[model samples]
Target: MTKLFCILDGHSTPFSVVVSPDDTVDDLKKAIKKEKEPEFDYIPADKLNLWHVSIVIGDDEDEKTITLSEHPDAKKLHATSEISEVFGSAPAKKTIHVIVQRPSQGSSAGTSSQVNSK
Candidate 1:
């Protein structure tokens, strides 16, 4: 098994998951959905907008944005490329901050701040 790190929504924070080298990009998507939203039955990978997410592998200095369909096969290669892109160029490791908004009670307000940090 190999570990892959991804930046969800371009936040400084990143999410990590372990995947079999044989697993496809599809598998990674499933794992991500399970980790981030276990309650949801399914999460369409394409809906994520491949360009919006960045991947980092190891010590590489190029960030590659790939579609979930392009992941699988040679998982390690993808992991390496992605990690290098996101973390390789920074002087210090960065953190990603996720912000969520909820509806406010009363006052006919419909806004709230509900963040989920991973």
Candidate 2:
């Protein structure tokens, strides 16, 4: 098994998981859902949509776009020249990054202070 660094939606918080070289991109998506979703037990892996997410391998700036419907083959799903040509170079290992934003409360003061100061 190989350890891969995953960045959830460009989020500063990253997760590390050990996966087989044969693991497909879809497999990774499942792992993400399991970790992030509050109701993962009710949700199915295939039901989740990740077509818009960008996948970055290692330190490479190039982002690979793949969906569950496409790139079923993990081995074939590597960062090919075709993808590299369009996106950029591929990293030696795979790395995924995710970004998320927290909802902001009204007022310039922090939530704790705003509620307490009032």
Task: Give the top-scoring candidate (lDDT).
Answer: 2
Q: What RMSD does model 1 have?
A: 12.8
Model 2 clash tally?
12
Q: Count the backbone clashes (under 3 Å) in each candidate.
A: 18, 12
Judged by whole-model lDDT over C-alpha atoms, candidate 2 comes out at 0.41
The C-alpha lDDT values of all candidates are: 0.40, 0.41
Best by TM-score: 1
Tens-place lDDT digits, model 2, residues 10-104 = 33445565545555555655665567667344445444433222454445444543233343332222221132222234323454422221223
**lDDT tens digits, residue span 1-118, model 1:** 5465554532434566666656655555556656666422333432222222233344443354334444333222232234334324331333221111111243333223457889
Task: List the lowest-lDDT window of 10 residues for candidate 2.
Answer: 78-87
TM-score of 2: 0.36
